[model samples]
Target: MPLPGQQSPLMIHWEASPEKQMDCQQKGKNNKTECFNHVRFLQRLNSTHLYACGTYAFHPLCAAIDANRFMLPSHFEEGKEKCPYDPARGYTGLIVDGGLYTATRYEFRSLPDIRRNLHQRPLKTEESPLHWLNDAEFVASVLVRESRDSPVGDDDKIYYFFTERAGEETTSFFDKSHVARVARVARVCKSDVGGKKILQRKWTSFMKARLVCYIPYYEVLRSVCSLDGGGWASTVFYAAFTLSAQWRTMEASAVCRYSISAVQRAFEGPYMEYQDSTRKWARYDGAVPEPRPGSCITDHSRRKGYNSSQDLPNSVLDFVKLHPLMFEEVKPAGGEPLLVKKSVAYSRLAVDRVQALDGRSYDVLFMGTGDGWLHKAVVVGSGIHIVEEVQVFRDLQPVESLVISHAQRSLYVGAASGIVQVPLATCARYTSCYDCILARDPYCAWDGRACRATATMDSTGLVQDIQSGNKGCRSISGRGSLPWKNRTVLQGDDVLLPCDQRSNLARAVWLLNGSEVLGMGQDRLRVGVDGLLVTDTLPQHSGEYRCYGEERGLQTLLAAYSLTVLPEIPRSPTAATPPHAASQAANDMKVAYISAIVTLVVLCAVLSTILLYMSCLEKRKGKYVLGEPRPSSVELQTVSANCLRKGHREEEEEEEELTYPDGCLRIIPGEAPTAATSPIKELPVAVPPLPPPLPAELTNGMGALPNVLRKMNGNSYMLLQQQEEPLVSPLYSASFTEELSKILEKRKHTQLVEKLDESSV
Candidate 1:
């Protein structure tokens, strides 16, 4: 897709050849999902064209697309070695000087190889039992221009990042889960060609070293984002890593930064040789070859009568083929990760260098999570502070790719749904100087009026403190304040004050008068998700309530409210009443007292008469008991049988209502259960059994008793008649329903849990 200024976006759809699609379908591949064109590699070839390739239904194809028209030609080149046949494979490539350098799986069952294509004579890594690449997953590739102003006039180099498994002997149960796989950084000279004779059509300047991070149990590389400093000596790369599958039980990830000079030194160190007898890799201490086996063709090498790799001697080429691994491991710059996060797995990374108002360039990292969130952070001296987080996708899909545009100040995010364009300079979200400063974002600054983008405005009045966030903003005038909202309520009534925070990194703190409220309380005061709720309002609570946003110990007022509690008026009569009114009131009270005594005496007499009659009746009929009557054997047997039938019917209904193959729980009110619709159904209940039959002796012998009295005395019929519906289990009613509600809430702004203890809900 192309977005031309003031014009509709243009989209060019590419389809696979019908013959290839049919072949893939016949081989047991899914026709709807697998046998389709999926573009995997796209890079700019020149000013007006782009080099692109795709998995054309298992037959790889490449084409040259016109940049202006966004269309491709009919003819395409065979991309068997340059692109992978499977779109799901890990492939990384770059186009430098019209030559494509790629690391990909060339065939269906062959090992992955790194090759240089589109050259006069294509060259690739040697296929040997030493296993140069063993189950490797490529992450990224970058070209470092070292030919400009080089002290030794060294050739340009292309670097590749990946993670691969170790040798077979070192993959025991204890080692495989901890140290079986290690991240690698490999490089090759751009001007290198095939060797003379020993290793024809193969690279002679290939060398790889281990990339080490200080994080424990996180050695696998997931993604890499590089920053070019206009010189190879100053370039740096930021990589994200996670734990291996066997040790991965929590959502934890880390980002480490490495310098190019550190990686270069590792490549120049000792070589690691694989010993056949021991089946292990160790540092080589053998004879050294002239011109150093894996060294690039520099001025000193040219002076030794070797102008190109093809002119190298047989001895040097043989040494290069045997020892391609470096001994020294390249460690990260601070001996620690730039940031280690828990409960979030970062999948993609992008860095943007911004020149702040203070004239210092800062690298702002944009990290994408597996659950469709984007975290923006800035480097502050030796530490990092997260500015904010934004949800880029409505669905919880992993972020696939990220691209940053410096000219437009926007970041492009790619996921399963589609592409999302987010602005890099969202300074307007920070309303106060303290919030803007505490954020430490280089692209934003406080301009004495409001937080604004530093790129578009000048630095005359802009204030930014990227290192130390404390800029004495506690007394700053008009610091993100709102007008007081007057609220009047009667005594003992509850009141709510509204305050909404936009940043998840900051916590909202409520202040009564001038002192801060202690914690989110439950008695008479508390902080809810919407705002501050105060119950049982009194005159003491009638004061100014201000909500301040605090982050990293800095505070900024967000909202304010004024409350007034009115006292109740008296309703009793005063002393200025007339004499006639008092006399009337006294006479009324005396008559009321006499009526109450008469009523009490009449009710007491009725109770005594009833008690005497019940005693006399019990004595007359010796068979009648005072407590509840017992059921006969016939009634007990009938109730038990009915309960057993009801249990069976409930089990069958439960089976029908709980059929979910995809592990997603869905319930809809007033909807019937079906395979294609909802899965909630009300289990049928057995009707109350008819009243138990009267005892035969009571009906036949009690002729003097009334008809209603005889039936009531025969059995406890009321106990069987009263029946209510059963309550649903809390596991299905509350927990599962809450999960379904969260699924629906994802369409809006998804709430993220912060690491702070005092953050507002």
Candidate 2:
């Protein structure tokens, strides 16, 4: 028998040989080789049930037996014995937290009896006599595995699922018991032993519905493997089957997936409830009420208005309608039950099928069937095409498990007999050679004769050369066969070296020292694929080139190419330099030098132009001119005053003088002279006399002018001397003064002004 860690029975033949093993050890010690074992097979045991003395393994048998043992007794003692719910029937028969536990029908029936019995006598078990579950409640049935569905959890609780037995008249008569009813999965802890007889918490019912009608009737939940090294937690996938009563009718099946997060929510509380607004006792919330320790209520009157905390909302009750696999309805050719790959297989194997380390996608599938057959399939457009099917066993025993060794490119199949190894590439048509080589995967290349690396000989040599260069400073020289052909060429003949552009240039050299090459120098020797050209091949130009290059940073030499000058050269001697070639070369050199100098001069000129343009721009934008004096404030003020005086004189001249209506000068007419007796030519005085007595209305408020006039009324001689001077006419132009006499004669009030003047005198 193979040990738990040993590779299964079939892969034993693929083990390494003693010599190869010794070589591997020696290589490891010497550090000469990086050993990669491509072929590896591992067999991992399903020891999840071994904990708790394999209680999960024994639960089914125990439940089956317990059902029979308690069936008749429970029926007989019905109301008299008050049979408690069976606790053992609810055992989940799953490996949880590294232990195996179970709930059975007998345990559910005996729960109440056990609680009562606990008060009288201590409950004891072989494993631990003082073990007792704490804060436990029996919500609903936790057992009854109809579709081989197991719900596993880390907490010390087990759940049993059962459905109400349907009436015989219903279509789903046999499936009556398939309806799902969940209960709190619990276990007695060793620490909580002998503390309390009654549990603090009570089991609360959440969702309950007929089983056959629900889309996904069964689900198996397993722990999710953590890539971050966290311990396993629950992730669930379900397989459901829908059957029809008609004979030979095809049954549809699907694999459904559910996230762990969804299940945790469903288990938190009851999912449906009925609230009565009128009565407080009838109104029940969805919380699990505290359990009364030792009290047993037997009266119907007291329980009539009693509210139970097991009511749930209708929203969570609809979870049964959500099916994860909505499209997996078609059946394969085989009439086998639909099998869902485990979560681990989906995460590791299926994911690895598509993604290789080279960042390329592979359309491959490795299907390990229960019938000891390994089926290889590749994903084509929209469908999967089966490539090969290999039967590793003669008998039709199912393959218990399967694993892929990516390092080796091998598949390990575990069966009842043992384990077997199959090369993955051998089943594919294109041989998967490139992938194997590029990946440097463990599986070696087999070419019908021997196994070797799939890399080309040249590529291998190149890689080896690279490695060799890294080891020391030695140069790599071209080997035995030149790997090139020699050619003798005539004048003007072109030679080509079919080398990649990435190839070393220094490795190529020609022996032209003997030839009188005019422009030959270390820098002037142009190297390219078109082999070295010595125009006008002279007789002395025939030689070989021991090309040199740096390989992996070290200077190295390449193969030599021999050249012989042909006697039959071109008739025109076209290989010789042109007649103007020297002049052209000199002109080109001169042009290049001139261009450099011109560029420098142009650059300087451009800079100078820029500076001059900037200076001109600044001047235009308003920079001060040199040697120009600015106007002073005193000068500005004097100019402004002169302008104001000129404006005032013009304004005064423009004003028209007011004349008396009589058109006569009223200036002291009695004392001086009338217009008719004016002195000499009677020249008009540029002024007019002020006459006329002040109106009483005008002098009504003026006491000074009235008093002066009253005093003057008594003395004419004094009044004549006291009379005011005449007012002047501002409108009369100096040139128009001669025309004033004719204007004064046109008025009739001239005499009144004379009389008023005489009265004043």
Candidate 3:
């Protein structure tokens, strides 16, 4: 066949020798010649197969042979030809410049076929799919970069660094506009296929200026790197890079200067270094001269070439090795780029770095592996030096997640089987106390000693004892043991002191007044099954108490209690006396005094009145004279003659007549009437004693008695007569009869009788 632009005619022929003769001899039978011939034919084909890029060969060997082979155009079409080995399987390769290339065993497909099969139409209300990346197998990493032109705007771009089994691929597109400053970037899984997922992006705002420059780098083996920076004067810069392989690697660095805006367009001059000998900033013009063939660098400096420590000069090598480019510079006006923060590595296979949200850098790197093991390392200059590794679980189970609360200094590890946690400080030294051993703790266990939880000592008994100043003590004793002892007792009531004991048949003795009270034969005291039973509690019983029991041949005081039995109040004497009895006695004495005074007054008045009346009567009695003479003149002459005869007849009877001046009747006496014979001759009637003077009738009879009788003695003389009655006094009379009545009346009328006797005297 003639070539498109060639001129030589080519002729080919096959020469058969021993191998050809054996190949023909084995046409119908199997032999050593046939086998040798077949083996030679296969070898020839294998050599030709090894030359083609489609051959299954080692990477280094295949790469050397077809290093400059242009990609095939048919690999980009959506048909069986796109995937020559497996027509049914979807293509996964790279489409670059106008052709498709396979770097591994994967096939290839055009961008159009992927769009139709994987990409869905955008909702009417949603924004358009400005950036999209399908084919999960080809996507090894994704990163987002903020534009510096709109520092405060939400314009952010996404760069997808992918690698197929066959070749490396890259695609960049706008993700969202108006992204916030200091935004937090993360990847979330898409919710469609079980294993097929995509990245979901979100951000937070914390800074005044937006991120201006962001870039990502990766290798064909799926290693990833990133850098980002933004600021007013482009003075501050931060960068992060990572390489993911069998053993992962990470590098993070930062740099700052007074001003990055003063640099020129082409050369900002080589970065300076503080040489120890000179003690000054020395210009190092050959630091990172250029990125290598398979590498790229983006920054304010225009040196775009492969980067390697060997290729860089000493001055430039030290600058790049010590203070690498932290962030790429974005030239808005082609002047100095603005300042931003460090870029973060984004990879599907790389583990996310744990950082303190408080902006404090980590002194140690703590990584939780898919297998239930915790790897700890310290941060060195540019690498992590692993110090310890602990198998957190017996089985090699994957760890689901991890949570660290810095305030509590707690670390929680969530695993596929269960959850475990421990204090980070304690666990840092890998000591026995790192884990909790108490059986009751749900979230912790005892590695060997002490009580520990996720971040605290959840043992209630221990915590309570510690807080009460009995840190190492087992039980809370002292006042807390008997909660009811510090109590009050009411007067005249009994109180029980609880003495709880666990042992049966334990002899407990209570002491009072330095003597044992239990079994003392005292009726007031008793020993019950629990404690001492006090019958009557008195004020004297209130004192120190001790309960002792014999344990292991020694007297043990189990508890002590103070009992205060209050005193009973006394009753008032006055209130106890009966009111009615006292009042009656007082009334009786008053009546006696009143009666005596009235009686005495009446007696004195009666005596005085009686004495005056007696005096008057005596005087009137003297004035009255006996007038016998008038009758005598006429009787004397007749008496003389009778007297002579009376003497002779002395012994004979004699008659005599007596006459008063006021009376006409007369009695003649014979002689002197002989004492024996005159019988009779009423001796001149010794004139009957003149009648006692009659009392005058009371004129004012209001309080005096009425007159009893009236009599006329002579012509004009009037006398009020006193009626002589029974010998008994009328005042004492009950109709003036009965001796018993007289005595009773005398007692009843004693006052009146006494008055009358005084008047008579």
Error of 3 at 351 (Å): 7.8
lDDT of 3 by residue, 553-618 (tens): 223356777777767766587656556766655443332232333333433444455445445545
User: Per-residue alpha-carbon lDDT of model 1 for 1-761, expressed as tens digits?
Assistant: 44666677677788998999999999888898879888888999889999998889988899999999998887899988888888788899999999999998867777889998978878898877456787888999989998888999899999999988764344223444354777899999999988878778888899999897854334578899889855678899999887666655766788899999999999989888988899788889998799899889999989988999998888899898889898888998988888878788889999987787777778899999998999999876655688888999989999989999887779999997899999998998876677778788888888886888887877887888887765736464334547889999988899888888756766778878868573565468878657898888878878888887776677667888888888754455674556799766654333333333333443344345544654554576443231233233211101113343444465477643322211122222233333244333333222222223333223222111111111122322121211222432211233424433433343225332323133211
Off by over 4 Å in 2: 1-98, 102-195, 198-247, 251-253, 269-355, 358-761
Query: Model 2: per-residue lDDT, tens digit, 1-761?
Result: 88999964531122224554465456442212222222111111133211111111111111111222222121111111111122122222332332222322223223321121112222321111111221122222222121123232122223322222221122332344453221122223211122221221222221222222123223221111111112223322222222323213333322222323333333333322222343111212333332221111113312443232222222311221111111112122232322333211211112123432223343455555445666554433333434455787777675554566777766787666787887665512323222112222212233432334333222222111111222311223323334444657675454543322223223343434323332236432445554554455544556655444333333333445666767664445566776698666654333333233333443344345544654654565555232224233211000112333444465488743322211222222233333333232232223223233223222122111111111234323221111222322232222223322322332223322212333343
Model 3 gets an lDDT of 0.32
Clashing pairs in 1: none
The whole-model lDDT of each prediction reads 0.74, 0.31, 0.32
Candidate 2 TM-score over all chains jointly: 0.26
For residue 34, what is the lDDT in candidate 2?
A: 20
| Top candidate when judged by TM-score against the true structure | 1
Q: Is 1 or 2 the stronger prediction by TM-score?
A: 1
Q: Total clashing residue pairs per candidate?
A: 0, 56, 35
Q: Which candidate is the best by lDDT?
A: 1
lDDT of 2 at 468: 20
Clashes of 3: 35
In candidate 1, position 48 carries an lDDT of 90
